[model samples]
Target: MMGEFRDFVARGNVLDLAVGVIIGAAFGKIVTSLTEDLIMPVIGFVTGGVNFTNKFVLLGAVPESYTGSQTDYAALKAAGVPMLGYGAFVTAVISFVLMAFVIFQIVRAANKMAPAKPAEAPAPAGPSEVDLLTEIRDALKKA
Candidate 1:
C-alpha cells in the first residue's frame, strides 16, 4: 500500500497538477494586484477619478449611531446598511476580462515559442524482406 501511494505521488499527472495549482494561485495574486493597483487606478484616472469600489446605493436605513460617511460602501456595510454594489461588480468584471486577455496572450506567446513536433520517419526505399524472399524462391524454382 505504501508502494502504491508512492507510485501515485510519483506519477507525472499528479506532480503536474500540483505544480499547476501552485502557479495558478501565484498568477491569481498577480492578476489581482494588476487589477487593483495598476489597471483600476489608470481606469479611474481615465474616467475622472471615479472610485468604483466605493460606489454603492444604500437600500436599508442608516444606523443612528453611525458616524462615518453615509455614502461610503464599507462604512455603510459595517453599519449594517444594505446596498447595491454595482460598481464592485463592474470592477470584478473588468478584472476578469483583463486576466483572461493576459492569460490568452501569454498562452499565444508560449505556443509561438514552443518547438514543433518532428516529422515522422519515412519508409526505406529498397525492396522489402518479403519481396526478396519471393525473388529467391522464384530463382530456386528456375534452377
Candidate 2:
C-alpha cells in the first residue's frame, strides 16, 4: 500500500494535476486582482464614474447605506437584506469574459509553441532470404 501510494505520487499525471491546481489558484488571484485593482476602476471611470457593484436595493431595513465592492454581495445576504445585485453580476460577467479571453490567448500561444511530432521512419529495404537463396541457386546453376 505504501509502495502503491509512493508510485501514485511519483506518477507524472499526479504531479501535473498538482501543478495545474497551484497554477490555477495563482491565476485566479491574478485575475481577481486585475479585476478589482485595475480593470474595474478604469471601466468605472470610463462609464461616467458609475460603480456597478454598489448598485443594489436592500430588502430589509439597514440603518446606513451599503458601501462596499461586489465581493460584499454576501454581506447583504448576511444582513438579511434582499438586493438586486445587477452591478455585481455585471462585474462578474466582465471578469469571466476577461479571464476566458486571457486563457484562450495563452492556449493559442502554447499551441503555437508546441513541438510537432516527428515523421515516421521509412521501411527497411531488403530482399527476402528465400529470394536471395533462389538468386544464389540460379547463379550457381549458370556457373
Candidate 3:
C-alpha cells in the first residue's frame, strides 16, 4: 500500500494536476481582484458612478436603536437583513465572461503560432514485375 501510494504521488500527471490546481486558484484570485478593484470601478465611473457592489436591497431595516450608521450590503446583512445580492452576482458573471474571453484569445493565438504540417508529394509510379522481367529477357537475348 505504501509503495503504491508513493508511486501515485510521484507520477508526472498527478504532480502536474496539483500544480495546475494551485495556479488556477491563484489566477482566480487575481482575476477577481482585477474585476472588483479595477474593471468595475471604471465601468461604474463611466456609467454615472453606479456602484455594482453596493447595489442590493435589504428585507429588514436596522432598528432605530442600533447606533451604527452603516448602509452597505454587509452592514445590512449583519443587521439580520434578508437581501438580494445582485451586485456580487453581476460582478461574478462579468468576471467569468472576461476570463473565458481571455482564455479563448490565448488558445487561439497559440493555435495560430503552431507549426503547420508539411505537404506531401505524390508517389512516383513503379514498373510492374512482368515489365521488368520482359526488359531483362530482351537484354539477355540481345547479349
Candidate 4:
C-alpha cells in the first residue's frame, strides 16, 4: 500500500498537477492584486470615484439593538440584517472578466512565441502498392 502510494505520487501527471496548483494559487493572488490595486482604482477614477463593492440593498428591518453602522455591509450582516451585496458581486464579476482577459492574452502571446510544428513531408510520388500489383498481374496475363 505504501509502495502503491509512492508510485502514484511519483507519476509525471501528479507532479504536473502539483506544479499547476502552485502556479494557479500564485496567479490568483496576482489577479486579485491587479483587480484590487491597479484596475479598480483606475476604474473608480474614470467613473467619478464610485465604489462598486459598497453597493447593496437592505432586505430586512434594521434591529433597534444593532450598534454597527447601517450602510456597512459587514456591519449590517453582523447585526443580523439581511441584505443583497450587489456591489461586491459586480466587483467579483469584473475581477473574473479581467483575469480571463489577461489569461487569454497571455495564452495568445505564448502561442505566437511557440515554435510551429514542422510540416510533414509529402508522400513519395509513385504508383501505390495496389496499382503495382495490378500492373504485375496484367503483365503475367499478357505473358
Candidate 5:
C-alpha cells in the first residue's frame, strides 16, 4: 500500500495537477484583487463614485448587541445582521468572469503555439498472398 501510494504521488499527471492547483490558487487571488481593487474602483468612479460594496438589502432587524452603523454592510454583517449581500456577489461574479477570460486566452495562446500533428500516410497497395501462390504454382508446372 505504501508502494502504491508512492507510485501514485510520483506519477507525472498527479504532479502536474498539484502544480496547476497551486498556480491556479495564486492566479485566483490575483484576479480577485484586480476585480475588487482596480476594476470596481474604476467602475465606481465612472458611475459617479457609487461604492458597490455597501450595496445590500436588510433581510431582518439588526441584532440588539450590534453597535455598528446601519449603512455599513461589512460592519453590520460582522455584528450578525441578516442581509442579502448582492454587491459582494456581483464582485465575485466579476472576478470569476475575469479569471475565466484570462484562462481562455492562455489556452488559446497555447493552442496557437503548439505544433499540429501531421496526417498519417496511407499504406501502399500490394498483391494478395493467393495471387503470389498461384503464380508460384504456374511457374512450378512450367518447370
Candidate 6:
C-alpha cells in the first residue's frame, strides 16, 4: 500500500497537478489584489468616489455594545448585524471576469508561441480486396 501510494505521488501528472494548484493559488491572490486595490479604486474615482465594498443593506438593528459608526458596513457585520453585501458580490464578479480575461490572454499568447504540428503523411494505397479476388477468380478459371 505504501509502495502504491509512493508510486501515485511520484507520477508526473500528479506532480504537475500539485504545481498547477500552487501556481493557481498564487495567481488568484495576484488577481484579487489587482481587482481590489487597483481596479476598484480607479472605478470608485471615476464614479464620484463611491466605495462599493462598504455598500450594503442592513437588515438588523445595531447592538447596544457596538461602538463603530452606523454607516460602516464592515463594522456593522463584525457587530453581528444581518445585511445583504451586494457590493462585495459585485466586486467578486468583477474580479472573476478580470481573472478569466487575464487567463484567456495568457492561453492565447501561449498558443501563439507553441510550435505547429506537422501534417501527417497519408498511408500508401494497395490493391482493393475486390481486385485481388477478381485476379484469384481469373487464375482459378485458367487452371
Q: Tens digits of per-residue lDDT for model 5 on 1-143? A: 99999999999999999999999999999999999999999989999997889989999998888877999999998887889999888899999999999999999999999999899888887879999999999999999
Q: TM-score ranking from best to worst?
A: 6, 5, 4, 1, 3, 2
Give the number of the best model, judged by TM-score: 6
Higher-TM-score candidate of 2 and 5: 5
| lDDT agreement with native, every candidate | 0.88, 0.82, 0.86, 0.87, 0.93, 0.93
Extract clashing residue pairs from model 2: none
Cα miss at 133, model 3 (Å)? 31
Query: Which should have the higher TM-score, number 1 or number 3?
Result: 1
lDDT against true structure, model 6: 0.93
Q: Give each prediction's root-mean-square deviation over alpha carbons.
A: 5.4, 7.0, 7.2, 3.2, 4.3, 2.5
lDDT for residue 84 in candidate 2, whole number 0-100? 77
lDDT of 2 by residue, 1-143 (tens): 99999999999999999999999889988987888788888989999998776766666565366554434667776665667778778778887888899999999999989998899999997899999999999999999
lDDT tens readout by residue for model 6, 1-143: 99999999999999999999999999999999999999999999999999999989988877889999988888888889999998899899999999899999999999999999999989889889999999999999999
In model 2, where do residues sit more than 4 Å from their true spots?
A: 59-75, 118-143
How much lDDT does candidate 2 score? 0.82
What TM-score quantifies how close candidate 6 is to the native fold? 0.83
Clashes of each: 0, 0, 0, 0, 0, 0
What TM-scores do the predictions have? 0.71, 0.68, 0.70, 0.76, 0.83, 0.83
Which parts of model 5 are misplaced by more than 4 Å? 122-143
Give the per-residue lDDT digits (tens) of candidate 1, residues 1-143.
99999999999999999998999889888888888888888889999999888988878788788999877887788778888988888878887898799889999999999999899899879998999999999999999
